[model samples]
Target: MSNRNKKIIIYICCAFIVAIIFYLFPHFYSTTMREAFIYFPEDDQIEFIDASTNIKLIDTKDENEYYLEWKTASETDKKAYLRQDIGFIFENGVLISTQSEWREKTKKLKNKVTLHGEDSGRYEAITFHFAEVHYPDDIIKSKQIMTEDKHYVIDTPLSPLVDFKKAKSQSEQRGKELLDSIIDQQLTYTVEGLIEQFKINKESYHIFPLTEIAQFQTEPLPSMSQEETNAVIGRMWEGLYRYYLLGTNTFTEETYDPIGNTMPFVFLSKDDTHLLVLYETADKKGQQLLQLIPKSEDNENLSKNEQ
Candidate 1:
């Protein structure tokens, strides 16, 4: 083959070779399809089920249940933080991302991980939340699951405080302050439709404190005797309570925009892990506010799931 033809042939061969490597070793190969696979138990093979994103917060009558509430400010009028009944599932605790099909791997990272996608958009890096958690059958059946909201928030607050520049700044400041105030504000609400439709007892309801450390971890062990389950769950519960007392809890909400100087995204894990928002500036801030997340993995089920 001529030199040019030879060069073209080499390019094609390299492309085909790269594609094969990507298919087999995606982590070493493909770059854009990073995702988080949260297995309920603490293990490597636990696969997340496919579902739509219509999860709402539940308000609890009993301390065990939970509720949903949204807070935002209005621009035209003074914005109100509206609390309403939405979708909610009972969980020992509460908790995102996209879809990808890359399960059949040779090696495994055994731990329930919160996979964080790097900005390079190359390899997906998942930071584990907890090692693993153990739950009793009763809590699993009784506890409801809480979902997140991915919506736009309105900033209400403009004018009169000063001039045009100050007015703009004032509105921005209000939003920032509001969101800042709520960073540790415990979020609580009631369960959905079941109550409005049926006259349920005031006792069946529950709410979870949305703070920085209200997290519960999933263990590697499956269902066990009630005594064992409660013992384990008890320890986890104690940890969560401690977090609440210290005022160090952080619940995950997608939209937080007050005056815009606050660390907007905070997540409280069931395992008592604290996800915090670190801000770089006071105002006219820079744009680097990603939560510094740690990996809390429960990959004990690693060996069992393989079979």
Candidate 2:
């Protein structure tokens, strides 16, 4: 072959090689990642399970049963229960994500008659309130299940507050567009219905309240102090509680505003084998399902050393 033709042939060979590598890249990366990060538990202890024998926060038929078990469970068992129940369980580890639930209340007034009221010909009124409260079961059920083991979440690479702000800004802009579209079409619908359809679509925002600390390693290090635990728990609880409340309420424009500066919660595991930190910011990809694998001692040490 002429030199020019040989050069062209060489270039084509190089291109073919690059294309093959590229085609195999994702499969290679996925296999490597799964091997490196995924760890399945063998003979794992079942701290809690529903009547059907599936893992769950509580079986709707008998919530009291789980509560009774939890009361006597060791700290380790408690953590395990909460981690699998409320937090995101990957393999052996769990991601302590924010948690929240839906709540509703109805009020009614009834007239009551007493001897004194009858005599006076006056009406006495009694007020009653009924509320709808949910356990972890309801919260998990609402989230989109990516697979048998994965779930979707609205992720943020920054602090939770920043994520909330971005969500709010986006929500407001979307809300305005929806509102404008309604006006343009001159549709006759209830204001609440329009807002419900246009604004607060539950599927889009899986509101997770920061209620539990199962995502952290609860094992206090020898150098760790009770004061440290108290501080961490206290700070985390406040933020989690506030966020939970925000999630429970209707998605109004005002509700999207940032609450304040808050740090993600962290806790030690009961075994002191791992340190779990909550909300290190996550990538917005692949359903945002948080999964964790056991952190080997070497990786843990390396993480601490880097820190």
Candidate 3:
């Protein structure tokens, strides 16, 4: 071949490779990013079972109990089989009993508040099921949990009636402008001001020394809508943590050890999904805000423990 022709062919090849990379990069990124967050089980976990409401009750030897699981699939021409084939979005979700209905066994499932055919929120006294599948060596002793000194509990289902007189007054006087200033100032506010605004009474609420747990940021999982997330928080928790609107972030960095010495703050997400109850110690001299951000599959820090 002529030298000029050879050079042209090389240039064309280089351009084609670059174009292919550009075309394929997005698809590759999307696929890899999604796998991290989605909860699809491996083929080894699938079992043959009858389908009901597009969900299945799988009895795995490891589980020892039958539980509800689901898979998303395309509805099209298919082959016949004794058991339904597992589909795209597979999840070993909430547990269902093999012997009895789950609703009967779940005593805390009572007092459900339904909104638009879904459970909105309610006070349910139920057992928490852990999702971790740990090996024998990795398992912690039950006595260790019982021996832990630091424990907190809700004595009553009802939230202690708070006198929001002080909090209400400040909000009325400051109006919406106060909230704006709180954000622009990066969550700097007077200790007394928030005490009144949120009605945090020593008798009603257990005031704690602001620990690192109260000082982190988080985002909701992608499956949660902002409103749904807010509803979940409101139902599951008590006090000022529930009613905070979007865009409210309050913090004071004055560090104090005793609860009496610290200033309380409200950290709210922009979309109002997540929240943090933080405090500023009396001696610390910086500003902090409860950070609530939306969770995306690609977020490396998305797994932070939440209250």
Top candidate when judged by TM-score against the true structure: 1
- Please list the Cα RMSD from the true structure of every candidate, rounded to 1 decimal place: 20.5, 26.7, 23.1
| Residues 253-305 of candidate 1: C-alpha lDDT, one tens digit per residue | 22232221222222223333232222211232322212222222322333234
Model 1's alpha-carbon lDDT is 0.27
| Ranking of all predicted structures according to TM-score, beginning with the best and ending with the worst | 1, 3, 2
The lDDT for every candidate, in the order shown, is 0.27, 0.26, 0.27
Expressed as tens digits, the lDDT of each residue in 1-307 for candidate 2 is 8999999999999999978987977345443332111111111232222111012222112211111001101111112211111112221111222212111121211121111100001011111111112235332111100101211112122312111112247654454344336432431232223334434333332222222332222443234443333233333333333332232122232333222112222334444333322331222111111112233454345334433
Q: Estimate each model's TM-score.
A: 0.23, 0.19, 0.20
lDDT of 3: 0.27
> Where does model 1 exceed 4 Å of error?
1-31, 40-203, 210-307
lDDT of 3 at 286: 28
Q: Which one wins by TM-score: 1 or 2?
A: 1
Worst 10 residues of 2 by lDDT: 116-125
Please identify model 3 stretches exceeding 4 Å from their true place: 1-258, 272-278, 284-292, 296-307
- How high is the lDDT of residue 94 in model 1? 20
